[model samples]
Target: MKKRNLFLFYIVVILFFTGCVSLKDVSVYKNEEISEYKYALINSTESLTSNVGTTINGVYVSEGKTVNPRDIISGYLMKRGFIIITEISDDIKDKTLIVNYGESGRRNILFGYTTEVTLQFISAGTKNLVCSSTAEGIGDREADDIKKAITRALEAVFEE
Candidate 1:
């Protein structure tokens, strides 16, 4: 019995330490040329609502809040000295950078939650793909994991 308890304790410890935010994969198709664009627009394709929760007595109770990935992307761009534009005007399109973002996540039975964030940067004027990147993170909570993934993804996209 003592040996069994010790093994169980070790398992718990491993899970606790392993359940953390991390970048899984990062792919940069283009270099840091995105710095040339002064204005940016974030287009998020992720679902508005996240269904990360637990089932309680046959009903699903959500523990994670519905967070818009666009907000996070916007903040990152602003911090990078890029002006965020709400609307894309024809005149500004030539100097504007368009960001397309998407996210997906799943819960692990033994570990925690895993979140993946994908980003694509396009030049509004030329309508060309400037850069793209992907990042993944794991955490005990859904919201935190998603945020971590987004941050990592942005870093990968900007190469900063």
Candidate 2:
């Protein structure tokens, strides 16, 4: 009986660990019109799905205070030689790096699970696609996932 209980506990632990990490699919594309862009702006974040969860956890609905793409990208891109900007100024309008969210993917409920954040990088002046990628995390809430996604996005953009 004790052995059975121990086995069940281990199984539960494994399940939790496996479910915690996000599942991500990323694709990147850039246009030839890429030029000097000094400031990065987060244009929008659209949510397609409502908060989801089974009775096991409870609903993980997001409040407006949850998370924003601007905050995430800005936090990471700061060190990577990108000037993060909140609002567009006349001087920075032409040279802005626009980060726009693509699709509102799934949102896991209960215990603050993962959400898929799809974003496109575009040049403000040319309106050319710089790159697009999808990353998974508790994108609406988890600060850590946001940071990781930004790091991955920047690496994809600047590295290649």
Candidate 3:
């Protein structure tokens, strides 16, 4: 019994450290002046396509706030001198930045939890991608994994 418990403890520690890879990658385009535009938050398309089995320390994790990628990205942009506007007007299309983001994740019994988010910055008028960033994070709990994915996505976009 004691050996079984010790084995379980080792597994948890390994999972925790390996999960903290830090997701530090980003790509920023300089053609368009991102800092000079007024940005609008576009609601992220999110879903939990499947949750057949999610566990922490071998116990199922199924309760937590459903976080949106838009919120995290916008909140981060707010601090970077961007005015987060609700409505993107045609008049400001040249100056408005449309943020499009999405996230997907799955809970694996063997690997714990993993999440990935793709964030895009588009110029409304040109319909061209100004900049884009992708971030990935992991956690034992589903909610933490999701949150980390979003926060890291934002960090990568700004890269600050």
Candidate 4:
């Protein structure tokens, strides 16, 4: 009886710690002109955080560490052949794309974290919207949840 009870306890613990990621409420829109751009500038809004952490100017800082979602978004854009630009200069304005990224609806569940991420693409010169997408992710860790949420959101935007 003691060994059976121990085995059951172990199983419960394993289940509690195991992580899971999911995407939902994904919406995507793309404009035909989006293909004309080759460079991108990413702008991120303030990230929602639980009461336990602090956010500085749209950057999430926890335990003296900073988490910037723009970095993740930049990586995805690079993979899609978009050159990342730090600023908007007249020389490249006509061929540049502006990407707006934000996070919202962050919550901590009983044993995991959930995050919702949104992405939008726009033409820098024309100032017109090109594409947009929204996605949600859930996992045992907050960082992983955010990462997966952004990845899923970008995938939805690019239809990949």
**Order of candidate numbers by lDDT, starting with the best:** 1, 4, 3, 2
Model 4 agreement with the true structure over 1-160: per-residue lDDT tens digits: 9999999998888776653433456778777556688899998545433334567999987652234678888988899898998899998998998988777677665465578877888889889888887878775356666777888888777773
Clashing pairs in 1: none
Model 3 TM: 0.68
lDDT of 1 by residue, 113-147 (tens): 57777788899998998888777766555667677
Show how many residue pairs clash in every candidate, following the order shown: 0, 1, 0, 0
lDDT by residue for model 2 over 1-160, one digit each (tens)? Answer: 9999999999999779666655565556666433477788877553222343444357564433344556556666676667777787777778887888643465555445664556777877667777676766544445445545655665666663
- The 0-to-1 C-alpha lDDT of every candidate, in the order given, reads 0.77, 0.62, 0.67, 0.76
Evaluate model 4: give its TM-score.
Answer: 0.71
Query: Which candidate's lDDT is highest?
Result: 1
Task: Give the best candidate by TM-score.
Answer: 1
TM-score of predicted structure 1: 0.73
For residue 71, model 1's alpha carbon misses the true position, in angstroms, by 0.4
Candidate 4 deviation (Cα RMSD): 7.2
